[model samples]
Target: AIEHDYHDDAPYYMLLAWFKRVPRSSDKVMLLTHGLMNINRWDLAQELQSIKDDKRSEQGTFSKD
Candidate 1:
């Protein structure tokens, strides 16, 4: 499970549930993009870049302004 606090007073959660899943050894990727008007951070960009560089993964999130 992955959790992000978003550094806000009101807490929010995004839950991903999978049932009867099959694993594969391929470069299948899912990207999530979020728009933020009040927040700005480049850390997410670096994280995503690192993941892509590794070339072995699935499922990720990238939040941006």
Candidate 2:
């Protein structure tokens, strides 16, 4: 669906599609991470998870401020 809609820009447009369709940022991250893992891209998935963790930590700190 995203590839069909984006054509040549699917890679970049996927994020837009996710945000438009998924509602939450964490769910967006999970969707992308799981998709990558399904394709055996474990390294990328782990990296994304790390980034998500970092962002959550940052949000937690900011909320305490």
Candidate 3:
């Protein structure tokens, strides 16, 4: 299984995309969770906006390179 920081707020669709990108033989499963007090952070409703923007910029640079 795979685990993330939990504060990253990555959604199911994002997780699924990552999963699909994995090789079929990887046999990996991703588990996302947060502490009771931190559950809201996992929602990613706000924190991810900046991350998404940054990722787009990074991808653009990589493509240009």
Candidate 4:
């Protein structure tokens, strides 16, 4: 589905394409992480997880002001 929708081979581009198709009500990060892991792309999954954690941390820092 991701490949058919997004014809790019790059992980970043592929992720962007896949994300666009995901429903707004869903836990997109978790879904994306699982998808990456399902394809044995644990490294990408970890990277996505870290990015999500960093974003949350930044949001928390800003909200404390």
Candidate 5:
């Protein structure tokens, strides 16, 4: 199971991503259960960067007044 404790006072997100005994998954290989909890940190970084850019744009516009 993949558990991410993002905050100390907030509920964590848990995702069952693996098998206990490496069960025979050949027939069920089509399942995308694995990597289901894979968090792409870069995606969030890009979002934060976008927000910063927007703030800068707003600041520039106000500075021109």
Candidate 6:
């Protein structure tokens, strides 16, 4: 799970972008962490966006669904 500050407005997509680049973690863990981050941000749209981005990345594209 992620520790978050609701007052912070840093773009959620940025975190997902970085998550995809880390070399040592499993996809499941990355997704789980992303989930927690979005939950903490109270941004369902960002959560969905992250999942779509992950799928696109797995398919060799980094665009939207």
Q: Give me the runs in candidate 6 sitting further than 4 Å from their true place.
A: 1-42, 61-65
Order the numbered candidates by lDDT, best leading. Answer: 4, 2, 6, 3, 5, 1
lDDT of each residue in 1-65, candidate 5, tens digit only: 12343554232222233333346855222222223224555554555566667988999999999
Residue 33 C-alpha lDDT in model 1: 15
Model 4 misplaced stretches (Cα beyond 4 Å): 1-17
Arranged by TM-score, best first:
4, 2, 5, 3, 6, 1
Best by lDDT: 4
The C-alpha stretches of model 1 lying farther than 4 A from their native spots are 1-39, 56-65
**Residue-by-residue lDDT tens digits, candidate 4, 1-65:** 89765555576786688878989899998998998899999999999999999999999999999
- Pairs that collide in candidate 6 are none
Best by TM-score: 4
Error of 5 at 21 (Å): 43
Q: Looking at candidate 4, what is the lDDT of residue 23?
A: 91
Cα shift from native, residue 36, model 5 (Å): 18
lDDT of 5 at 21: 36
Better of 4 and 5 by TM-score: 4
Question: How high is each candidate's TM-score?
Answer: 0.28, 0.66, 0.33, 0.72, 0.41, 0.29
Candidate 1 residue lDDT tens string, 1-65:
12233544223323222211324553223322122212443465456556666654433223321
Q: Which residue pairs of candidate 4 clash?
A: none
TM-score of candidate 2 relative to the true fold:
0.66
lDDT of 2 by residue, 1-65 (tens): 88577687866777777678875546778888999999999999999999999999999999999
- Indicate whether candidate 1 or candidate 4 has the larger lDDT: 4
Whole-model Cα lDDT of every candidate shown, in order? 0.37, 0.86, 0.57, 0.89, 0.48, 0.63
Error of 5 at 26 (Å): 50
- lDDT, model 1: 0.37
